[model samples]
Target chain A: MNNNEKDKKSLIDDYKLHITILFISTISLGIGTINIPLINGFNLVLLPIMYSLFLAVLFYIYKPAKWINKSQSKTCAEILLILISPLIVKLAIASGENIDILFNVGPALLLKELGTVGTVIIGLPIALLLGFKREAIGMTSSICREPQLAVLIDKYGFDSDEVKGFFVVYLIGIVLGTIFISILTNILCYLVPLHPYSYALASGIGSTSMNVAAVSSLIALYPALSDKLLALSGLSNMISVVFSIYVYIFISLPLTEKLYEKFHKYFN
Target chain B: MEIDLSFKMVSEWIGILLIFSVMAAIGNYVGYQYPFVESLIGMFILCLISLVGLIVEKLLPFDNIPAIIYISLIGLFVALPWFPLADLIIYYTSKVDLISLTTVLLAYAGVAMGKDLGSFKKVGLRGIIVTFAVIFGTYLGSAVIAHIALAYTGMI
Candidate 1:
C-alpha cells in the first residue's frame, strides 16, 4: 500500500482505539453512577454527566498517541479528579452553610427535587427509546463493516418480506424472554428474599451497561441501599461480562454461522 | 400556566436520537467486526444518548432550567412503573429481573444482523424461526441456571 494509504489506515486504527476507550469509560461510569447518593434527587442522570465530563477532559488533556497506552499519568489524573470533584462540591456546600448561603440554596433544593422527578418520569424513556433505536442503527452499520458477518447477512438474502418476518419473530422472542426472566427472578426474589436492588443487580448481568443505568438510578433514588446495591451490581457485572464473552465466542457466532448454512433456503 | 416545551427539549431529544442511532449503528457494525463488544457497545449507546441529552440541554436555548425539568420527568417515569413491574413479577414468581429477557432480545438482533443469506437464499423464514428459537432457548436456559444456582445456595 502507498504511504498515504498506510497513514490513513493508522489514523483509522487510532480513532477506533479512542472510540473503544470512550465506550468502556461510559460503561464504567454507568456502573459507578448507580451507587451515587440521591441527595436532592440527583442520581444516574447527573452522576454520568459528571463522570463523562471528567473523561472528556482527560481525553483532551492526555491525547494519548495510542489506544492502549497504559500511562499511569492518565489513570492517576482520572482517579484524582473523581475523588476531588465531589469533595469540592461538598466543601462548597459546607462553606455556604457558614456564610448563610445554605438558606438561599435550601429552597432551591425543592425545586431541584421536583425537577428531577419530572425529568425522570417524562424525559428518560423518550431518550431511552430513541437511544435504543439509534443503537440498533449503529449495530446495523457496524455489521455492514464486518466482511464475514456482512457476507453472512448477504447470503441470508434479506428482502422486505423476510425483514418483516424476522421483525415479528424477533419481537416475539423479546416478549417471551422478558416474561420468562421476570417470572424466574420473581421466584428467586421471593425465596431468597433478595432486595429489589439485588434483583436489579442480577438482571443487570445480562447487559452490564444497561444494568448500570438501572442500578445507578435505583441507588440514586434510594441511597439507603447504596452499598448493597453497589456490591451486588459489581458482582453481577463481572458475571455478565464473563458470560457475555463466553456466549459470543462459543455460542453466538458459531451457532449463527451453522444455522445460516442449514436454513439458507428457508429464508429465500 | 402551562410551561412551554423549549427548544432545549427538542434539541435534547434530537441529540439523543442521533447519538442512539450512531451507537446502534456502531454496535451493529462492531458486533459484526468483534462480537465481544456487543454488550459494551449497547451500553455505550445508551450512555451516549443520556449524555447527549444532558449536554445539549446545557449548550442550547432551554438552558438548565427547562432541561432539568424535562430530564427529571423522564427519569421518574422510567424508574417508577418499570421498577414496579420487575418487582411485581419477582414478588410472585421464581424469576429475577429482566436482564435475561433483554439479553435474548439483543442476541436476536445480533443474530439477525449477523446472518448472511446468499442471493436467492430463503433467510427470511429461517432467520425468524431461528431468532425466536435462540431467544427463547437462551432465556429459558439462563432462567433455569440462575434459579437452580440460587436454589442450591439456599438463596432462593
Candidate 2:
C-alpha cells in the first residue's frame, strides 16, 4: 500500500470500533426521526433521540477509557437504571389510588404463565427438544437473572449444584439478554396483534435495563399509552419481584427438575 | 479494581460533580421542569442514594440483586407525596424525559455490543440462535396469555 493509503488504513484500524458505534447510533437516530412532526411549530419530539445521538458521537469521539470494559459497562448501565428508577416510582405512586390495577394486572401477568414461570414452562420443553442437557435446563428455563440468583443462593446455599447452571445463564443473560431483549421486544411488537400494554407487561421481565429499552421503543410507537404502559410495567415488575420468591420455591425449581427427568433422556 | 482512598479518587469525584452540574445547566434549555440548579441537586441526591443502596445491597446476605431494584423500591417510597421533598423530587425526576434516557442508554448498549463483538463471535452461531429462540418462546407465551385475558376483560 502507498504511504498515504497506509496512514488512512492505520487511522481506521486505530478507531474503527468507535466510528462504527457512532455510525450505528446516528443511523438509528435518523431512522427513528423519520415520521416525527413539527409539534408546537418545532420538532421538539426528536430532541431526546437527537440528544442521545449527540452523546453517542461525543462519547465515542472522546472515548471514556474507564468505561471500555464489560464490568464498567454493566456498572454504567446500573447507574443509568438508577437515574431512570424514578419513572417506576412515579408510575407506582401515580397509580396508588388505583390500586385496583394491581389486582387487575397482577393476575394477567402471573396467570399468563409467562415471566419467570412461563420462561420455564415454554423454554424448558423447547430447550429439551433442542438437545439441551439437564445441567443447562435450570438456567435456560428461568430468566436466570439477579433475583433468581439471590433466591437460589438463599434456598440451596451458594454451593448447590443448581448454582453452577444459574451462573452460566446469568452471564449469558447479562452479556446478551440485556441488549437482545430490547431489540427482540420491539420486533415482537410489530409481529404480535396485542396492545402496547401487553408489550409493556412483557417488558417487565424482571430485568430493569431490558425493561427500559423495551418500554422506550414501545412508547415511541404509541406515545399516548406512555402512562398506562409505564404503570403496567412498573406494577408488573413489582409483582414479579414480590412473587418470584414463591414462584421459584413452589413452581420453577421443581418443574425444572421434573422436566429434566422426563425429557433429558429424549435429548440424548 | 480497588478504588484508591486517596486524592486522585477525590479529584475524580469532584470532576464528576462538575460534569453533572454542566449537564444539568444544559438540561434546563433542552427540557421541561429540569431547572439548571434543581437538576444539580437532583443528581447529587440520586448519586448519594445509589451509593447507599450499593452498600446495603453488598451487605445483604444474597447474590444477584441488582442495585437498580434496591434503589428503585426505596426511591418509590421516597417519592410518595406524603414524603418530605417529594414534590421537589417529582418535579426534577419527571423532567428526566424517558426518550432521552432511552436514547442515551440504548446508545450505550449499542456501543457495548460493538465492543464485545469478539466475545459474541466466540459464542458462535449456536449461542445467537438459542438466545433468540428462548426470547421468542417467552414472548409468544406471554403475549398469547395476555391477549386472551385482555380480550376476555374487553380491555383490548
Candidate 3:
C-alpha cells in the first residue's frame, strides 16, 4: 500500500475505536436510565456502571467477530485512568460543598476507618480455613482495590501469589461488589440498629462505584437524608482513598503477614 | 532532562476526555433530566479541571502520588467560598450528575476487563468465597465502627 492509503486506513481505525466505545457506552447509559421499582419504593437499581461493565465484558468475551483487539483493549485500560479524573473532581467538589458538615463529624469519619481491619480479622480466618496459605494475607489485607494491589505488587512483585490473591478480590470487588454492597446495605439498614449516618460513612469503603451503590441504596431507604448521606459518603470515600495505602503498607499488610505465619499450620 | 510529553499525546488525551464529556452530558440529560446544554457546559469545566490535574501529575517532581489527589484539590479550590467562581462552578457542575460520569468510566473499565477475563477464570471457587468475605468485612466493619463512634459522640 502507498503512504496515503496507509494513513487513511489508520485514521479509519482510530475513528472505529472511538465509535465502538461511544456506541456501547451510550447503550449502557440508556439501559441504566430505567429504574424498576421493587417492594415499597425500594427500587432494584443495577447501576449503569454495573451494566456497562458487564456489557463490555460479555461483548469482548462472547463476540464471534474481533471488534476490539488486544491493542485497543490496552488503550481502553490507559484511558480508564484518565476518565476517572473527572469523577474524582466531582466527588471533591461534593466534599467541598459539605466540608462544614463533614468537619463536624470528623471524629466519626476518622474513627470509622479503623474498622477496615475487620477484613483481616474476619476474612483472614475464612481465607486461611479455605487453605489459602500466604495468599490469605493478600486477599484479606484490604478490599484489594488498585491501591492495595499496588502495595502488594511493590512489595511482592506483580507475579507473586499475593498479587494473584489481589486480582481475585479485585475482580470480585469490581464486578459484583457494587451489587453485593447495595443489597447488604439495604438489609443492614433494617436489621441493624445503626443510624443512617453511620451507614453513610460505612458505605464509603474506598471503591467509588461500590460506595455509590451502597449509599444510593441507603438513600432509597431514607430519601429525606439523601443529601447528607451522599456528602458523608463522598468524604468517607476520599479519606479511604487517601489514607488506605498507608494503612495497608504499615498496618494491614504487616498484620496479615504475621497472622498468616501463625495460622497457616493450623489450617494446613 | 527535557519533559518527554508531545503535543500529539496531549491532544489525544484531551480528545478522549471531550468525547467522554459528551457521553456524560447525554447520560445526565436522559437519567437525571438535567438540561443538556448546562450539563455539557458543566462537564466541559470538569474536563478542564481533570486536564489540569493530569498536567500537575506530570509536572510534580515526586512520583507515586495519584492524579486524583490533584484533581480533588483543584475541584475543592474552585468550589470553596474563597474562590471567586465558587458558586458558579458549583452550580454548573452540580447539573452534571455523578452517577452519569461513573457510567462512562466504568464502560472503559469494562472494556479493559476483556483481556483479564482469562486470568480471572483461573482464580477458582476458593478465591470467590474469600472475596465475599473480604468485601463484607470492610463494609460491615466500617459501618459497625461508625455506628459505635456515632453513638459514643451522642451524634446519632
Candidate 4:
C-alpha cells in the first residue's frame, strides 16, 4: 500500500482503539456503579474510592508509559475516576436491596431530598471524567501523529487564547446537542402518554452508557413506571449502540478529514 | 432461616445442571472458533427451538392447557438445577453473555477515550460546536422519525 493509504489506515485503527476504550470504560463505569451497596452498612463514598482506584489501575495497566510521564498520567487517572464516580455511587444499590424501600416517601419529596446529592455524587464526576478523558485522548493521539498539532495546542494552552476557542466550540456543541436530544425525546414520550422522565432516563442511560444508575434513579423517582423504565433502558441501550457507531462513522470521520486538511495547510 | 430440600428439588437441580453443562460445552467449542458469534448463536438457537416447538404444537392441534404445561416443564428442566451435572454445565456455558458484552464495551470505551481533541481545539469552538450539533441533531431526527412511525402504526 502507498504511504498515504497506510497512514490513513493507521489513523483509523488508532481511532478504533480510542472508540473501543471509551465504550468499555463507559460500560464498566455503569456496571460498577450498579453493583455498589448504597445501604446494608455500606456508604456511597466507598464506591467512588473503589472506582478511582480501579481507574488508576486501569490506566496504569493499559498505558504504562503514560503513568511514567507524571502529569499526563495524573490528569488521565483523575479524569477517569471522576467520570466513573457518579456511576459508582449509583451502583451502590446493586447490593441487592429493594430500591423501592429506600424511597417510600412520595416522588416529589424524595427527589427534593436526594436529587441534589445524586447530582453531585453521581453526575458531576461522570461529566468531568468523560470530558477530561475525551480531551486527553484527543490531544495525545493528535500529538503522536502530528507534532504540529501538539505545538498548536501548547501555544493555545488549554484555556487561553487559541485553545479557549476550540473548547468553547466543542462545549457548546456538546451542550446544545445533549439538551436538544434530551428535550426532544422527553417531549415525544410525553405526547404518547409515556412518562417523559422515563424517556429522559433511558436516553441518559443509553448515551452515557450508565444503565443501572439511570434506570434506578428513574425507578426511585417514579415507582409506578418501573417496568417501562427497565424495558426502555434496554431498548435505549440497543439504540444507543447503533447510534454511537453511526456517530463515530458519520460525525468523527468527516470532522477528522477536515481537521487533517486544515492542519496540512496551516501547520505543515 | 434454614431451608428444606425435597426429592423434587434435588431432581430439578440435577436436571438444570446437566442442561447448563451441555450448553456450556457447546458454547465454548463454538466460541473457540468464533468468539463474537458465541452469544448470538446461543440466543438464536434457544429462540429458534422454542419457536419450532410452538409451531409444531400448533400443527398438531394440541390442547392449549396441556401444551402450556408441557412447555413449562421443559423450560424448568432446561433452567433448573435438577442434577449435579447441571451445575457444571451452567457454570461453563452461562458466561457467554457476560464475556461478549464486556469485551465489546471495553473495546469501545478504549477507542472513545483515544479521540483527538486537538482537532476540535484547532477549529476552535466551531469543531466542538459542530460535534454537539450533529449528535443532538441526529438524536432529534431519529426521535422524530420514531415518533411519527409509532404514531402511524398506532403503537402508542
TM-score of each: 0.28, 0.50, 0.74, 0.32
Which lDDT values do the candidates have, in the order given? 0.33, 0.52, 0.75, 0.33
* Regions more than 4 Å wrong, model 3: A1-13, A33-43, A124-268
Task: Give the chain A TM-score for each candidate.
Answer: 0.30, 0.57, 0.67, 0.32
DockQ score for model 1: 0.03
Tell me, by DockQ, which candidate is best.
3
Model 3 agreement with the true structure over A244-268: per-residue lDDT tens digits:
6556777888889988888788887
Q: Give the clashing pairs for model 3.
A: none
The DockQ assigned to candidate 4 is 0.04
Residues B55-112 of candidate 3 have per-residue lDDT tens digits of: 8776786566555667767887788777899889899999998778776766666667
Q: Give, for candidate 2 chain A, the lowest lDDT window spanning 10 residues.
A: A1-10
lDDT of 4 by residue, A1-268 (tens): 0123222222212333333334333344344433344532221221221232344335544664342223333233222221221111111212112223324412321122111122122222222333422332232111011111122232233333333333333234323433344344434444644443334333432333233433444455567877876665555543333223223223432343354344433322
Clashes of each: 76, 0, 0, 65
For candidate 3, what TM-score does chain B get against the true chain B?
0.88
Better of 2 and 3 by DockQ: 3
Query: Per-residue CA lDDT of candidate 2, range A149-255, in tens?
Result: 54454444433445544544544554566457656765777776577777777677665555665666677778898899888877666555444544665677777
lDDT (10s digit) by residue, model 4, range B39-131: 334433333333333334434543432222233233324434453443432332243343232223223222222333344345554344334
Model 2 gets an lDDT of: 0.52
TM of chain B vs. native, candidate 2: 0.59
Model 1 TM: 0.28
Task: Note each model's CA RMSD in angstroms.
Answer: 23.4, 11.4, 6.1, 19.7
